[model samples]
Target: MHVAVLGAGYAGLSTARRLESRLPPEVDLTVVNDGPDHVLVHEVHRAVRRPAVADAITIPLSDVLDRATVVDARVESVDAEAGRADLDAGETLSWEYGALCLGSETAYYGIDGLSERATPLKSLSDAAAIRERFLALCDAGGGQVVVGGAGLSGVQVAGELTALAEERGLAVPDDIEVVLVEQLEEVAPNFPANFRRAVREELTDRGVDVRTGTTVERVTDGGVETDAGPLAYDQLVWTGGITGDDATGGDRPTVRADLRLTDRTFALGDAARAVDADGEPVPASASAAIRMGKTAAENVGRLVDHELNGSADEFDPRLERYRFDVPGWLVSVGDGAVAQIGPTVLRGTAARASKTTVGAGYLTSVGAVHNAVNLAEEELL
Candidate 1:
């Protein structure tokens, strides 16, 4: 029996790896990915300033998968009904059983010209491009900069920009500014109020202009036109938001619970619209993607087994309910940090240390133990 997995992001890779480890020897597993390496997405923001981080965040696909066949091709079309995917090379891939981990794309929010003018921080290339623009601004001494969105990515980028500016010992010109814009009245809207306050303080302390309850009305070659006014910017970074694979205008119903698109077809990670068994939506996060991957793999195993043995009685258990609330969140603001776990709020070096530990812990949990150690060592020294 053949099991095909598409996409190699956290959700897809995690599912593919789990299936590789547990499935029977008779199962033929194939993982289709557009890229040769799995890019650690969370670190992309930091990579904007720390170029060395780029190498540490990407892992070659070959190093991780032992038995699965890796197909290096971009999926152009997915015929879920026919259990097939059309490749960019005019080839067709068919599968008896498959998983879709298409992941999400950036949500432009319909802002006129923003998609063409702003550098989005979605992929490694996007991060690198932003880094270039940031450094250019830094080298030119000063310029008006705008970071759209106050979500996790926006907060991080704003912080990193602050750090970068300080490192250059550069003072903003009378006309130059670094502003963060958010539609909500408050920044970091998902985090607790206390956490949001801490972040605002951190940004304020670092001299970033934080604006809330504002929307980008339009974007042009010079800058973003906001509801507040025309904000001129030499560099514009978009950390706005993202939507599921359906953003491509595909007709696949926004993925169901259990991460399955149809019988024998599953969608996991950002590509899938993750929802609970009760049909409630789950917040999109890396943690959710990883869990969905494992769950999808287990269910795929059951499909393979039932087909092989004709045992209708032994179907894999129903997909488990996934509920998550980040008890605490951490954000690095230049050399310091703002962290909250439960009601315990921390700032300064303690918070910075916590941020470092969290980063190391995630690396280790994702089977990047060696990289984790290297990171820890770097931070310690």
Candidate 2:
């Protein structure tokens, strides 16, 4: 009569909250994660320009969870079959039902010197470091800043860097040499055509050099080694690849249709290779993770009820599967942004508003109204 959820990211938080609302009062629940507060991973990029935004984007776990034990400890691994999770501090937690929603980390791809040379944008500390280092470079007479990804995060980081340079009166594209390198031929490979074009235009307008169809082969202290050639840069950031950290999160284990790695143990989010009703692999994104987390929570609740009732029947509860849907896409680039919500594609004020609304909506859903309101005020004002 217990359910344990791991990590406090989008998937874990959503699952825990939904479980609290659905599970019976007798059931004990525990949430194990590495941190006390939930971070808005997407908003971490903006902290580069507005450092105070880091505070507004994080909410203490106790501020949201109503009835659950929140364990702020690093989980080493989960023996799903054994129903036990090992912690980094030589402790183990046992559970009847569990959900593994530990998120992803940067993938350095075994490229020589890349891990040591390239900075990653996977955490709040990464963003904060970028902010600090970028300013330091500016004060040291500014040089080339190369971003090794043209994805949403990379575009946003490049945009923020561009704005920060302009704010500090650093040279636009010349002295800074802010370049966004993408392996694909387009800026946003998976986005709509119009949105892709819009992002490219915005980067161009913001004086960011956009290099398409370029592959980064290695990283050096001086710059990135790519298929094109050695591109000189003072600071290099990698935002292109992501993979599950197996030691922290579980390995990408095969899960049953109900997302069960073992009986009473479920795996969701980036840590699991999840599929939908049609058996197609679901892509990892915050939106997908949130939806999958709720589904997993509901299924876990059903299993708990079956166990407590001690049903004589087969006790095969019908489980819900995640249905993939493009719930729209929004990318904010400094003062402007572009969004494609359903059939509508927008830019400028409409897009910026849409982006802000999505962010505020996420914060509101997690019961961080004060932080949401303050973020809005800080962003707008």
Best prediction by lDDT: 2
TM-score of each: 0.90, 0.95
| Tens digits of per-residue lDDT for model 1, 1-381 | 788888888888888999998789988888888888877786677777677777777777887788999989888878776789888778788888898887777788888999988888878888889878877878887788899999888888887887777677776434347799999998888777999999999888878899999999999899688888888889998888887564235432466665667776887676756667666776666767777877788778867776778775665545534444456778877666898988988998889888788878867766777777766665545
C-alpha lDDT of all candidate models, in order:
0.79, 0.85
Q: What does candidate 2's lDDT look like per residue over 148-210, in tens digits?
A: 889888999999999999888888877687989999999978677888998899889889999
Clashes of each: 3, 0
In terms of TM-score, which candidate is strongest? Answer: 2
